[model samples]
Target: MPIRAGEWLAHGSQPEWTMTVVEKTQGAPRDAGPLAELDDHGLVAACLAGRRDAFDLLVDRHKRSVYLLCYRFVGTHEDASDLSQDVFLRAYRGLRRFRGDSSFATWLYRIGVNVCLNRVSMRQPLQRSLDEMPNLAAPQADPAVALVRREEARRVRAAVARLPRKQRTALILRVYHDLPHKEIASALGTSVGAVKANFFHALANLKKLLAADTRSGS
Candidate 1:
């Protein structure tokens, strides 16, 4: 599909989520002024002009987000890596077709979510288990810190993975990807209200799941 630019809309009550930016081409209206200063559209433009190096800047910028998206959606480093490659490769090949009508990351995540959905649809029932997918991205911490952080991340991913498809997508897109509701709608191919509804259910379930995990541990 041809890309449109900057249509990443947010809900009226979006949470304050800061995103890292990346570098972009000079003299563009949105130059990547600071390292990680590049916006979605700028990266798209540079990559489309045969500047593969520009794509690296975008990769470095969103790699963690994309990797986390994969981990949350699939719960395994194996599948996430597979899907991450699919996401970026699809982007690279499809860049020329983009019309710059949406934020590049939004469009990219639309790709990510769809990729996950397709993977889920193709899985066998027994293969759909969630408890095995752990968040392997925990930062280096003291033994106690690592234990606490890893424990929390594991609990969160398990809860998120158990959510129904819509809820999981909404929760991950909003909480993990830091996208607003409307952009999430665009990515999920749904409405803003639906996105909110899904996010609510997903978060509620995650909280419940976390509470249960805590109670069990205690």
Candidate 2:
């Protein structure tokens, strides 16, 4: 996908397939043709130009990852879906502030992190459990082994949630989302050094938390 500049939407949906375009004689959509080929910035431009379909494309592209991030925060599919929509809505409303300082995905993730953090703080002690880890077994694999792995993943997630805010954010963005320290720093509004320090402590603390859990037979 190529990122190009447009007068409007200089920055930033769903899957490419879900965007249905219709040809109109007047007010024909810009970048309507081959929208999937345009990069995120280009789509943002189109969206600014009043092409709703372009925003839909952006949502399709990012919805899965955004939902996953929200799920990790709230730990429920329903809440995650609602937060994902809220994230996109906020992004759409705040598009003018994007500034193109970071990649579109990074900017969107920053918004998501803020939204999730606010939600978590409002409802201290997030009630849901993180049991949505991917299935690691073949169809014929042993159920007991899968259950054990799921339990371990759940414990690890619980430990992560217990981490200090900065450490948890650093670890989640770095480990789960595969974000670089620089990007995580940008998202966290902190320095790369701080991000690294937090991530390191997050790992060490996570190990201690899990070990304690084991010793306690939990």
Candidate 3:
């Protein structure tokens, strides 16, 4: 059962969505060093030395954040899972090129942003069906109140998805990921000033979109 490059790993309910296994390295330890004991740099170095398990560890550590970031852009668990897997595959293939100019997380975020932007650009703007919308209800909350909140949140997500690519990326990195302006700029490959501008404009556009939705409902 050796996984080969370009093979798919089925994830979740999306049987059509597959994560590619970019390369299989020899001499990778079956039971390698405890990944929790190593820093990113250490794991990366181990991976370079043909320890495949190190990369698995790296994936385990960052996959949640990466998946959440993907979900913010695509607005579906299936698409986000697909994109997140793609991000990791790209990261694995590009590991040797990493020069440590930034933290590994920042570098990974940059890759994820690029992958998402490319995918987003090739398709029509994302629109979530009611079934695709997230359930944002709290236990014991009134059903009516929860429904209203969920609808509002969905509107906001839709508004964000409709933003210009750069603005959307900047806003997601800053607001959702809680990344600072400098880190966001690093992730987006832009200047700090530019990141701030994009965030400002994204918020302004979201306000307009949401307000229009509210006014129409009144």
Candidate 4:
């Protein structure tokens, strides 16, 4: 019962659309009571036991955060949506290898970070700013204020993008995703101290970039 391309509506509340898509794709039962009550570990066990809908439950639970993380990395709705789907697909394929060394969320985040980095590496230089991307404003906000906000967001994103790869990843995970240092270290496959150092340098570099942008009257 996956939603067909023609059946998908572009206009609607985001959460509503996301749930509709998840329900359709997973074909989850209407009585998802027990499945929904199980924790991540339980759901993972169910998925391994051939309960494909259990995996869909995971998707429904985590999709919003995953989408937001992808959006932060790519700064566009379309790319983020595609990347989020890719993350879940990759997670599904790799489920057998999941050893429970970290939380499921952390493990999934590691996959997402790797996928985004690979995508970024393969793309042209990030010449597009956040303002030029999408979804930085409310529907009825003042146009002038929204423009200013977009410009500021664009400047910050540009600065973050210019950091060394590790630093950039650390900053995005820490600030944008609000992951703890230990969780971030697990995701990046680095030590906690290293993650801290990367975040420190990222902040320093961001300050300098923002200052420069301000001075240049951008």
Q: Which digits, one per residue and each the tens of the lDDT, describe model 2 over residues 99-145?
A: 78888889998999999889877875444443554445463277777
Per-prediction TM-score to the true structure, in the order listed: 0.66, 0.79, 0.81, 0.81
Better of 2 and 3 by TM-score: 3
lDDT by residue for model 3 (1-218), tens:
44533354345334544455545544333465576588889899999999888998888778889999998888788889999999999999999998888889999999999998888888754576766666653543687776677787788888898899989999999999999999998877779999999999999999998898889879
Q: Which residue runs does candidate 2 get wrong by more than 4 Å?
A: 1-32, 125-140
Clashing pairs in 4: none
* Per-candidate count of clashing residue pairs (backbone under 3 Å): 16, 10, 0, 0
The numbered model that scores best in lDDT is 3
Q: Model 4, 10-108: lDDT tens per residue? A: 674244334324444343446676898898888999999998889989998888889988877776678889999999999999999889989899999
After superposing candidate 1 on the true structure, give the runs of residues whose Cα lies further than 4 Å from its correct spot.
1-43, 124-145, 207-218
Relative to the unseen true structure, what is the C-alpha lDDT of residue 162 in candidate 2, on a scale of 0 to 100? Answer: 84
lDDT of each: 0.74, 0.81, 0.84, 0.83
On the 0 to 100 scale, the lDDT of residue 100 in model 2 is 80
Q: Which pairs of residues clash in candidate 3, taking residues 3 or more apart in a chain or in different chains? A: none
Distance (Å) between predicted and true CA of 89, model 2?
0.8
